[model samples]
Target: MTNDMRRDFANREELATYLKEQFPEAAERDDHISPIIGGRQAAVAALQKVDPVKYAKSRNFLTGAVTRLSPYIRYGVLGLREARDFAFSKIRNQDEAAKFVNELGWRDYWQRLYMKLGDGIWKDQEEYKTGYSASEYATELPQDIREGTTGLVCIDSFSRDLREIGYLHNHMRMWLAAYIVHWRRIRWQEGTKWFLEHLLDGDPASNNMSWQWVASTFSHKPYFFNRENLERYTEGVYCKKCPLYGKCDFEGSYEKLEAKLFPKGEFVQKDNSQSWQKGKRKR
Candidate 1:
C-alpha cells in the first residue's frame, strides 16, 4: 500500500503481511507456504546454492536436485542473466548446464507469449486440441479436487502439497495437470485458477500457458500419464499408500484411454487438425 510497506521488512514475516495486502485471496488460501525473505541479497543467497549439473540429470523426477529459484525469478528478485552467469561461473561443464539454462529460456517464452497475448492467455489460444470438443470440458474444477478428497491418493496428495506448500515438483505438476485435463475433462482454466492461487512461483504467463500446454489448447496433443508412468517416476510412493491400487482411473493403454476417456472420437489421431485450423483462422 505504501513505499515503506513494500520496501521495508524488519522481520521475514513482514513479507507475509505485505503479500496479504497485495494478494489477499492468494495469501489466505495458501497461507502455509511461508513468505520468502525479500530483496536481492536473499535472492543471491538462494542463487549461490544452485547446482546446474545435478539439476540437468534429475530435474524430471520428484526428488530431483533442481534449483527452487522460481519464486525469486518470478518476482524479479533474481534476473535470468545473473542466474546464467552464476551457473556458468560455478560449473565448467557446458553440456550439463544446458539442461538448466533451457528451462530459463522457457520462462522467457512464457513472458513473451503473455506480453503478446495479454488477457488472451485466459481465453483458449486454440480449440480443444485433443480428441474432444471445447464443449466437452467442464468449466470449473470439481469440488473434490479443490477439497483434496479426490480418492486417488497420488492426485489428492499432490493437491494438498500444492495448496499447503504453494510449490510442486515440475514432474508432479505435469502429471497432475495431465490427469485433470485429459482424464477428467476439466477445462485448463479451472486448473489454471487453482494453480495460480497456490503456486508460490505462479507467474500468470508461465502458469496459464502451462495449463494450456497440458489441456492441448497450446500444444499438439493432450498430455496423458497412466498409473505405470506415475509409479515409475514417482518411486511408487503414492501408489503404495493409495486405496484404489489396481482399479484406479489411470489403468490402461492409449486405445483403452481413448475408449474410456473419450469414446466418441480419437483425439490422438486427427481431430486436432480442425482445432489448429480454427486457431489459425482466428489469428
Candidate 2:
C-alpha cells in the first residue's frame, strides 16, 4: 500500500501565507461582514433561532429576519431535509411555513436542473428573452462596476457588500442583476461570473439561471425597478446620500423604462399576452 500524504502549517501566519499563495482571490473581508460559525453544531444553533412566522412577513426587507443558513447548506455541513424539518417543527402553520419552505425548494430546484443540464448550465440556455439578440449585450462587466465606483451610492454599497462580505440580500441581488442586464446592457453571463467569484453561497445552478430570470431569459418578462422602489425597500438610506438621487439610472415605470432602454418596442408586455417565443423554451 502507498503511504498517506499530508502537509501541516506551522502557525496561523504560515497557513495564511500558504492560502494567499495558492488562492490569491480569497482575501480578507471587512470586520463588519456577518460572522459565520461553521460545523454541524453551529448550523443547528442557527437553525434553532429561525423564526418562520416572521421570515414570511418581512423576508423581503433589508433588515429582514432571514435564516442565515445558506453557507452551511452550500458546504454540505447541513442538509436541506434537516433544515426543512426544523422549519416545519417550529411552525405547523403551512401558509407561513410554506413561504420559507418554498425558498428552500428553489435551492433543490436549481440543483436538479444543474444535474440535468451538466455543462450546458454555464452557457446560455436560451436566447436573451428580452427581444434582444445575444450580439447586443456586452461580453464583460464594465470596469466601473467591477471597481465598485459606479457613483450610484446604493449600487456601490451593494457592490462593496458583495465583494467584501461575500453576502447579499436576495432583493439586492435582483436589483443589481436588473441594473446590469437591463440598464447597463451587459450580458447575464458576465454578471453571473462576477457574482460567482464573491458570493459565499454562490452555486452555479441557481446563480446563473436566476441571472437569466432577471434578463427574461428564464422568465416571462425582464425584471426592473425604479428608484422609488429601491427607496421603499432600503428606507432611503443610499438614495438620500446619493448624488444620482431621483435622477439615478432607473428613472421610470415599466412602460417608460421600455421606451427609454429598449426603444425597439419589440419586448413582450407585462401581462405575458405577447409571446417572446423566439428563444429556447422557458424551463
Instruction: State which candidate has the highest lDDT.
Output: 1
Give me the runs in candidate 2 sitting further than 4 Å from their true place: 1-18, 25-35, 265-283
- Model 1, 1-283: lDDT tens per residue? 6554466679667766677878787666556744455468888888988899888777667777868888889888899998998888877677768977878878887798889999999998777766688888889898888878989999899898888777888778887887888888888888888888778889788888877776768865666667877787788999998989999998877567767776665455322112101112221
In candidate 1, which residue pairs get closer than 3 Å at backbone N, Cα or C atoms, i.e. clash?
131-267
Which ten residues in a row are the worst by lDDT in model 2? 271-280
Tell me the TM-score of model 2: 0.85
Query: Roughly what TM-score does model 1 have, to 2 decimal places?
Result: 0.84
Q: Give the Cα error of residue 103 in candidate 2, in Å.
A: 1.0
On residues 143-258, what C-alpha lDDT tens digit does candidate 2 reach at each position?
Answer: 78876799999888988888877888877888888889888999989999998888888888888778877787676557777777777777888888988876878777767877
Which number leads on TM-score?
Answer: 2
